[model samples]
Target chain A: GAGVSQSPSNKVTEKGKDVELRCDPISGHTALYWYRQRLGQGLEFLIYFQGNSAPDKSGLPSDRFSAERTGESVSTLTIQRTQQEDSAVYLCASSSSMNTGELFFGEGSRLTVL
Target chain B: AQSVTQLDSQVPVFEEAPVELRCNYSSSVSVYLFWYVQYPNQGLQLLLKYLSGSTLVKGINGFEAEFNKSQTSFHLRKPSVHISDTAEYFCAVMLTGGGNKLTFGTGTQLKVEL
Candidate 1:
């Protein structure tokens, strides 16, 4: 079976630029999540979408970070006016349903802000 | 808000030796516990999860974890580790309700030496 997939395995951009990271969740998955992992740090929740509705967006560090999922399928995490602090790996995950307790993750998109 | 703690920032063990990574979580409600492994240049992989039924759960790559309710701990253990096990480990907890958002702890780097 195909697992989650992400685009642009690596991206190098200058500060103040905007970047978009894409994620393709597994087929029939109704739940999608976005997370960020700073260098030598842990995974931090960014946003979550369930069937096109974002029920939790509190984990998004700032307004500069935004994510959207359409029809419980592909998802995109966009960082506006990116800063050096936003240099990290953006991760995407999906589960079959709510409370499944297991999320399949995709190879993260590594963003380097200079 | 729920929080997870990885007591060890790094753990170094000789190949073929036993290893344990400690994890503790604090949450107001019952939650799902998970352990994920991230190899260099790869996505996070689900090691094991403790949702319900049994306190002990086994996962891929000879990994296992035990969920403790009273102590609020879910520690991962492997009797023998290979150099291939060298990677970063993260402990996470997701609330039973409230949209299945994950709260992750600072990662622990496991170095398996030959």
Candidate 2:
């Protein structure tokens, strides 16, 4: 793909229901990251995956939030028992090299937990 | 650990007026600085970055930022502005030699008025 792509641009789910957001990074990108942006707030780092190394989960808000990436392609961010506070724009980004420091981002998945 | 700080929550500027958004970062080691812009209902786009070169860095939309190691600042500036420049701006830092995790600031909203 020409750029990073994200699925389910907008989602509204009842509280406690599970929701999944998908991200397909740019081809050949070796680094992938997930972030959450609440209304009028800065992006909050959720997770990071570089190559086949162990993902950096230090930024996940809680245990209920989990993300997985297969190889360096598609990734899924699952929020278990979604809560109202989980409503936000979930963004995915990729970089050709982890050290590049410049990220290409997706349009983002707007999640609304009703 | 690395952290970024956007001093102003919102900045209102008139069309054709010059604008500057302050950003400060804290890190114990050498770091790379970046500025990203987000238009309404859109994803983030890289504006510019400072990566171990001259202190001044230029980016798209006539935006520029200077890396001030002494002050730990990477403030964004533009000599003239247009309504299309209205967007939310983010400051991020990535420590060199560290894992591929980016620490982001809370963001500053730039509202360009006529």
Clash count per candidate: 0, 0
State the lDDT of candidate 2 residue by residue for A84-107, as single tens digits.
Answer: 999999999999864468899999
Query: Which pairs clash (backbone N, Cα, C closer than 3 Å) in model 2?
Result: none
List model 1 lDDT by residue over A1-114, tens digit each.
599999989999999999999999999989888889898788888888887564588888999988877787888899999999999998999987744667889999999999
Q: Report the poorest 10 consecutive residues by lDDT, candidate 2 chain A.
A: A95-104
Regions more than 4 Å wrong, model 1: none
Model 1: CAPRI class: medium
In model 1 chain B, the worst 10-residue window by lDDT is B94-103
How much does each candidate deviate from the true structure in C-alpha RMSD? 1.6, 1.3
Q: Give model 1's clash tally.
A: 0
